[model samples]
Every structure is written in structure tokens, then in C-alpha cells.
Target: MDLYIYNKALALQNVMDTYGSLRWVRRYTECGEFELHCPFTVDNIRLLAQDNIIRKKDSDEVGFIEYRNVKRDETDRENLIVKGKLGEGYLNRRIVWGREILNTTYELALRTLVDKNCINPTDTTRIINTLILGDIGNFTGNINFQVSYQNLLKVVEALCLEAELGNRIRFDKTLKKLKFEIFQGLDRTSSQTVNPQCIFSKEFDNILDQEYTDSIMDYRNVALVGGIGEDADRRLLTVGSGTGLERFEAFNDQKGISNMVDNVEMAEAEYSALLSSKGNETLAETKKVQTFENGVNLNSNLRYKVDFDLGDIVTCMSKKWGITIDSRINEIEEVYEESGKEVNIVFGKEMPRTIAQKIKLL
Candidate 1:
């Protein structure tokens, strides 16, 4: 035999709130329950299916299912805790239960002032503006403000059409091309310098001209280091292993050296200020700031605010309440010897009576 339990009162309230009508089902269970013994009809099965609450199989059962008292489930308890923590769950649920209360009362009043002259709910633009700006108070004057599903669909379609037509024109034909004559020359010179047998130098009569080639190559390398052309090579040259000019060029291109020089100057100024102070306190403070800025980029909101006091409080609370509950359950298992019990009590019984109860008290 199959058994099912549902909150009839909540189900009725949901139906009434959605359709604004009471639907009576003859074969289904009610709020306060009773025992029964008979097979239900296909029409009764169809009614349950319509609400998406139950399913029926082609089983030839001989006995009717007993009606049980309606009660809230675990999802309801979890939702209660979530609402309580956020301070909005209770009011939202109250609104669901037909209690008319406005959370953003002041904002609604401001909306009423702005929407004094324009109060057309059926207008797609007006409906969209209200939702985007959260101005529901202006909708009070319009009887159709309580939007039907069909009206929402219409509003979505209108917005989508507007977005689709926004990018109709393209202007690639009128765009200007960047000049690259200087960069192209630099690339040619650098290629010839690296490989003396390149086609450009091969055509020259005095191809053994290392002096002329070296001068042009030096200029090309400098321009390349300054981000001039596509073929500008950026290979590093060691100081002791090469000529002074070559080593200087390589050292200049090494990344982050300029930033490090600036940081060093700033640190020196800060250290001087600290020395002028009575004690090492100011110096320590300045060092801390320098260390933080140098080691961390503090641009992302997540990374910047990660070490805040409020975040620590939330983390501590989560560990204590969320994780500690399981710890306490394990402790209970250690204390309470299950072997002595007469009845074959399952894990479900221990969960609700022991662990869940302890968690609530905590």
C-alpha cells in the first residue's frame, strides 16, 4: 500500500492565491484526517495530477489510503532559518500568505511622486520602467498593475525587439587604417642586422660593411625595445658576458625594474620620515603600508574586503552553528549507548529527537 501526506491548508491557500477560487476535490484528503478502505476513481487520480501533487499507477489495489494530518516539512524549517538570518524571509512569506505589507515603503512613496502623471500599466515601456526602477507605488492608480502572465510575456517581447533593432547600422567602411611606414622600416632593418645574408643586404655591393650594419641595427634594436615593430626581437643580453652597450639595452628592457626603482624611492622617503619621529611606530606603520601595496594589488572587491571584521564574524558564526551541530551529533552517539535500547530505532528517530533538537537549542 502507498501512503502520502500533504499540507491541505497550505495547498488550499496556494490555489486560492493563484486562481482566486476554491476547488473542491471529493476523493482527496482534508486538513484533519481519517481512516478509509476503498479504491479511488480515475477522476480522483486526475485531480491530484492537475495539482502536480500525486501520481497514479495501473495497480489494482483493493484498499483506500488513510488520510493523515497535514504538517510542515524540513524545507519549511530551513526556509524559516534563512529568512530569519537575512531579515527578509519572514516578510516575503507573509506577503505569500495574503498579508499586504510593503517592505520598501519610503521608496514606494518616492515612486508615487515621480509617476504622478504617467500611470498606464498596459504600456510596455511604462511596465518595464517600473520593474527596472523598482517603482511599484506608482502602479496603485492602475487597476491592471497586477500583471497577468500574458502581459509579462508581451513586455519581454517588446524589450527583445527593441534590443534587436538597436545595432542595425555598421560603419566598418568609414573606419581609418593606422600608419605603419616607420614600424615597417624598423622591421626590415632589424631582419637585415640579425641575418647579414638577408635579401635586402644581399643586393648591396659593400655587403662586408659591419660598421654601417651595426649602427642601423643598434637603432633598430632600441626602437624595437620601445615597442616599435612586429619583428622587433626582445632577447636579454647578460652584462658581464657582452659589451657595455648591449648589457645596458638588455637591463633596461627587464620587466618591473622601473616600478621597483619608484617603490625604492618612496620607501626611502617614508623611512626618513619615520627616523624623524620619536619612536619606531611611524616607521613600522609606513613599512606595513608599503609591504601591502607591493605584495597585493587590492583592486578586486572580493580580495580587498576578504580580511574585514564583519567577514571574520560571519565565518566564525558559520563554523560554530553550521559545523558544530554535526560535531554535537557525533558526541551524542558516543554518550548514548544504542545497544541497550529495546525498540529497533532507526537513524531517522535519532536525527529529529537528538541531533536536530540539540542544534535548535544551540
Candidate 2:
């Protein structure tokens, strides 16, 4: 990918003609952000201080600048964090500012992402309809969502989780649209397989590096979810268990509700889902592979010729590790630089629980 700088009017300012990279990461269950780093120059510094924008472009994707960092004596170049145009609405929301969305369906929540005027009274950006996908289903739920001072990206992620769906955004060059795809369970179906011989090890030219990680924090067998209704005195509790005492996690959702019984029922169902989702303790692996092949580029879009994508289940046999990794593509990081371009892929079923989701409600 190539990085370019643009002015407020969206005119080209500078092309990243120097040595650097346009870095980006995509997450299956969360939002993804972009970054650019190149040789620092006085003009770039001035642009950073002004209304200048940084963008990344390739055969398939595009990114818009959101924040910039300059490294003078400390480093060699300037760096910028870019957000895909599709993400502008979500990233702009304040974490502390919360909004209450009530009586809405899954499709409407998604519409809020593209239809700025529908969700935010002040947003003016045009909605891109071609990029939207998936059905919102028939059930409508009330969200006591606090504009929460949390940015819209995270807030919307939580909303999707509550609805038992997966959310992701990607740039589709064929359609020339920033595609936002939502799935009911896993993101994609696995039709590809990676054998031990295909993996880069001390033997393979395509494999550059690989790392494996395992954690118990992701394993939760017993989940206790509690909530309170409109009346402070009214309380509800639900417990979902998978195994005996391996670990116990509790969630106190204080999102206001009028009915305690209904809220508790919802909490129980959510707890059961959460328990089933996170009930795993296994070795997770991340792989980094070379982008060059016989002087041809392969690690970008063509790399997926093996057929793998975010939330897709794939079988990976690593002889060196003596274990087979069969899981979802939770996250992927792509790096482009003058030295060479490489693709970093991470595999896992679910992310570790965050403190925000575990917030205790009074």
C-alpha cells in the first residue's frame, strides 16, 4: 500500500515516496484502525500541524488520516493513524458521552453507523449503502446505551455482542466501497486447509516468523450476570455454568430497565452465550509470512488464495509446536515498507474480557 498526504479540500499534498510502511490491522469482533510511517520532512510537520490529511491507497483499500505523530531527533520519520472513511462516525463518538437508543432492531443499529443523521443529530456525512450487509433479524431491543463517553466504535461493538452477532469492515476494491459485514455467528466458512508443509518454518520460503500464545484468562466456566431495574431496590441475577469451579466471572449490567424479570431473563441468556463463547483454553498461534514470491507479490489479497478470513475456521498443523491450531482469524495486521511487505495473522476464538464490559452497576 502507498501512503499519501492530502489537504482539507482532499487535494493531494504528498506521496509517501520515502522508506516506510502503511500499517493496518483488522479484527473480527472489533473495529480496525490504520497507520502510516515515513521519512519525516519539514513539509510533513507543517501538514501535521494544519488541516492536512494522511491517506493510504492500494489495489484494494483506502484509509483516511485521523491523528499524526512526528519523530524528529527521536526517530527517522513521521507517523500517522488513519481511519477508514467508513469508520469516521464510530471513532468520533466520545467515550464519556453516552446515548440511549431504545426500541431498535439490528438493522437500525447498523444504519446508525452509515446514516449519521439517523444516529447523531450533528453528523453530515453521506451513508454508503452498498457497503452494508447481513440481516438485522426480527427482534427489537431497547438500549439504555449511555453515549458512555466511549467512542462509537467500541459502543457499537458491545451492541453487536449483546445481539449475538459479529461485526467487521473491509475495503472491497471490486465494489469500490468500504464494506461492513455482519454475521450471526462466526464471520466466514472455512473451505481451506494449511498443512505443516505449507507453513514457513526452518524449511519454507514463504514463512518469515511465527509465535504461539496461550492464556487462561479466556477460560470461563461459570458466569454470574446481575442487573437492576428502574427501581433501585429491584435486582435480578442469572447464572450460567459449564464446568465446576475452573473459574467464575460476573457481570453487573446497570443499563436501566423497566422490568426486572425480563432483564434477568435476558441476562441469563447473555450469560449462557458468553459462557459458551469463552469456554476454551488452548494454544493460540500468530503467523507472519513473507509477501514476495519469485519476485511477485502474494501476501496481500492474493495471500488468501489458501482461503482464510476473519472469523473463518481453518486447520493449521505446526510441526515445530507439536500442536494443530484450528480457530478463527480474530485479528490480522498488514505491514508495508521499503524493505518488504509482510502479513501478520492472529488466530483465536474469542478475545479476553474487558473491564468495560464487566462494569458493576449500582
Candidate 3:
């Protein structure tokens, strides 16, 4: 597991000097990050610099150096701890301006979002000419997206997660640029016969050290959307339907979603539809944390990235607890240390409910 280090210009500098450990996290819906601990030495300090790039061969993500720390241990050992984020994290440098994408191919909609925010924006000076949107994939369905003054990275990740898609930023060596791509994982679930079924369970002795969570502390099913008006005259609509305990209610304020647009060319009921779409989108983004955290057996017959990869939907069962669920592999953390390397897969993202919990998660 050699880590390739590159200069600020994306040119190969040298391999990371062996030292402590490297914890590289990869995600399906959003940009991932890493923390590398190496011996504190002149060579290591010079090789690891701010704005330099780090990547592993045969991988899509290229991490951007963000923070570097030097520490001296009790044993008189000095070490350098480096931290950074994946390439897609670069989108954090820009914001999503006022835009409404309605009834367009999802691929085109995504490309348009990136083009306007990263490349060829209305504000020419904000353009990142080197970032190119890749060709479309086999994605179908129309999208209605309305965003104003939002973080581009969060918006992109939310949309991709809702749509069950994967996003990446690959460093194109030949083109000397970053290629932004949208992809979907294969359906390797037990019920899907199209490809080989991928199931992880204690029965098969493939799943280990499980930590499952099933909580609805933040779940909501129905949204009572209020757009514009006052008191009894307020415009209102319902996004989802349910009865009794099945109805987890939420109130959505769509005051910014106007029923009227300044231009006459705008279609009728478009704003209303946008408001409804917003409600649905919000609901979809917020869901119960019924996910598990575990690792795969390295000696198992099943192989990663070949039979299953990030974003792939698969079946996981716990015999002791008698719980089985089909979920996506949302994240994977690779640990490389003196003991060797191990990969931990997160079936679903468990959102922390408290500030302290969130900080602990980070």
C-alpha cells in the first residue's frame, strides 16, 4: 500500500517516507479525508507541504494537503501528522448561486451545476478552467433543483445521496485536469439476479465486530409545507401522507419559494412545484439512522471493488440479533499501520444528534 505524493503542480515528487500509520477514508456520496502519521524528519517535512497532492494508484480520489502537525513523544520520538481532504472537497471553495433546474436529465443537471459553480460561471473570474465535467452515465429521470446561496459541496452530496448515486474527482494525468464524474454502483443485493449477490452475515463468517444502530430520533415522514401568506390566508400544502404513529410530522417553511416570478416566460405553478419538491428532497435527505458499522473478513471468498465497492447495495444480516437489512456501503476507512492494513465499511451514515457526538464523530 504505497502512498504516492505529488507536488502542487500535480507532478510526482516521491513516495511517502515510511513511519507510523495512515487512515484514509473514502465515501460514496461526498468527498473523503485522510490522516497520515509519519516520522518527523527533514525529508518528511520537505515532502509533505501545504497544497501538495496525495493519492494511491488505481484510485479515483486524490487528497489535497490541508494541515500538518509536528509532535515529540515521551520516548524521544518525533512524528509529523498530516491531514487533508479528497479532490471533490475543492468544491468548498465556491458557492451555489441562484439557480433553478427543472425537468432536465439528472446527468445534465449535475453537469450544469458544476459548470455554473466551478467552470464557465456567469462570474468569469470565479471559473476553474481545469475542472471538467465527464460524459454522462446511464442515469435516467428528471430533476427539479432550486438552490440559492448554498454550499456547492453539500448540495452536490445531498443530491447524489438522495438519488443513490456516487460522485468522484479523478486526476486525469493526460489532460492535466480534474474530471468530475457521477456514477451508480451495481445492484449486488441478494434479490438482484443481474449480478452476483453480495451478502455479509455471521452465518458466512464474513461480517465481524458489528456495531448496529436503529434509531428514529430524527426521522420524519410527513411535512406540512407553508410557503407564503399570513394567518388563515397562508399558503399551505402537504408533501407526504400517513395516519397515526406512522405519521412523523414536520413543518417546512418555504417563504423563499414564491408563487410568482418576475419574468413572464416562467411556467405556471413552477414555484409551487419547487416548494413541493423541496419538501420531498428535505424529507429524503433526513432519515432514520438504521445503519451498521463493521468490517469484512479479509480471507473471505468475496472481494472488494471487484464484486462490491462503495455505494453498492448489499444484504447484511446479524444472526445473534436476527436483524437483516439491505443497505448501501456509504463509506470505507482504510487503516495502514505496522500491524498491516485493514478496511472498515460503513453500511449507512449515522448522524450524531448532539454537538459533542458530532465532534467525536469528526
Which candidate has the top score in lDDT? 3
Give the true-structure RMSD of model 1. Answer: 33.1
Residue 137, model 1: Cα distance from true site in angstroms: 14
Writing each residue's lDDT as its tens digit, candidate 1 over 1-362 gives: 23231121112111211111111111100011112212233333332331122111211111112222223344542111000011111111111111111123222422332232123233334421211122132222111011112232222222212111100001111221111000000111222343211111112221211111001121211211111122334332221222455431222232211212223543433322222221111111111100000011122221211222110111101222222111111101101112221111011111222222111100
Estimate TM-scores for all models. Answer: 0.11, 0.59, 0.90
The sequence of per-residue lDDT tens digits that candidate 3 reaches over residues 193-233 is 99999987767877556666777788888888887789998
- The residue-level lDDT of candidate 2 at 97 comes to 36
Which is the winner by lDDT between candidate 1 and candidate 3?
Answer: 3
- Which number leads on TM-score? 3
Clashes of each: 1, 14, 0
Global fold similarity of model 3 (TM-score): 0.90
The global C-alpha lDDT for each of the candidates, from Candidate 1 onward, is 0.18, 0.44, 0.76
Model 2's number of clashes is 14
Model 2 TM-score on a 0 to 1 scale: 0.59
Candidate 2 structure quality by residue, lDDT tens digits, 217-279? 444434333334455554544444444565445554544432323344444444333323222
How well does model 2 score by local distance difference test? 0.44
